[model samples]
Target: MSERHVTFDMIVQAVGAVAGITHHEIMVAGRAGADERVHLRYACWWLASKMTSLGPSAVGRLSGGRDHTMVIHGQRRAEELRATSESFRLSTDALLGTLQALERAGLLRFAVTIDPLATARRVLSAPEREAVRVSTYEIVAMSRLIVEQADGDPSEPSTEETAHAA
Candidate 1:
């Protein structure tokens, strides 16, 4: 598949769409513990760092002007979560898949290949393959939710609770 240049904004937007969260929520300055907003922010940082040529520092700047250390920490945490948490891994993998599908369909301005496992492994200190519990139905549902949100569907799940659920 042909790869396309995916912008930071595009990555943030797509991830936000799949996660049922918003860019504002992610970029908002805060040290909110391990909440959904924080999770989304970290996921955004990890995705941006991988999907683009931007370094940790640039990713930090885009993500609320966070310091490189903070970006690094977030990336490390994301890697840890991806390796240890099945739900977290599925959520992240699903978002990446959604972005890839969007790119391939030309719904996005560019086309990009996103290999979640490979990307995560690239950042992981110790990578291990775990059986994925996510079914095709769940992935399709996540994709549908993302598409609806992107289309500005009024019925889209945008509530904080719904966003947290993803």
Candidate 2:
């Protein structure tokens, strides 16, 4: 099996796709008013925690700048739902299975080393960390723009072409 670094963004996108919600809805800060939205967000957290090498804080950072405690709570809620709800378990399991399939197909990637302190080592200062976080958001936004411009067709011109034409 080929290894790929499955990013936190990938998990969020996958969860959003599976749940029929936008990634924006999942990543938006604040308490989601809808139970479905809350549960989907929790599922994203649980999946990211389980699937990636990122720590809770890193996962939280990638997930709408949430606190580690909030990530932990979401994880716990997800686990509780999985234990008690067969439908929830089946859905999550299906999502997990889809990700696993992608991994096996060499489409999805995962971290190489499972370093516990990786998050700490990645950012030396709070300002640096925030910068990195902002960059991530920008990257995601750019990706969305590119995808939107592509419009499900690979033969389409690139983003630059579209921009230049405008």
Q: Where does candidate 2 stray beyond 4 Å?
A: 1-4, 29-33, 109-166
Model 2's number of clashes is 6
- TM value for model 2: 0.64
- Return the TM-score for candidate 1, rounded to 2 decimals: 0.58
lDDT of 1: 0.67
Candidate 1 lDDT for residue 131: 49
Please write out the lDDT profile of model 2 over residues 4-111, one tens digit for every residue.
466667787788788776666666644645778888888888887767767789877666568999999999999999999998888888887787777767775345
Per TM-score, the best of the predicted structures is 2
For lDDT, the strongest prediction is: 2
Clashes of each: 1, 6
Which regions in candidate 1 have their CA more than 4 angstroms from the true location? 1-4, 31-34, 110-166
Task: Assess the local accuracy of residue 10 in candidate 1 as a C-alpha lDDT between 0 and 100.
Answer: 77
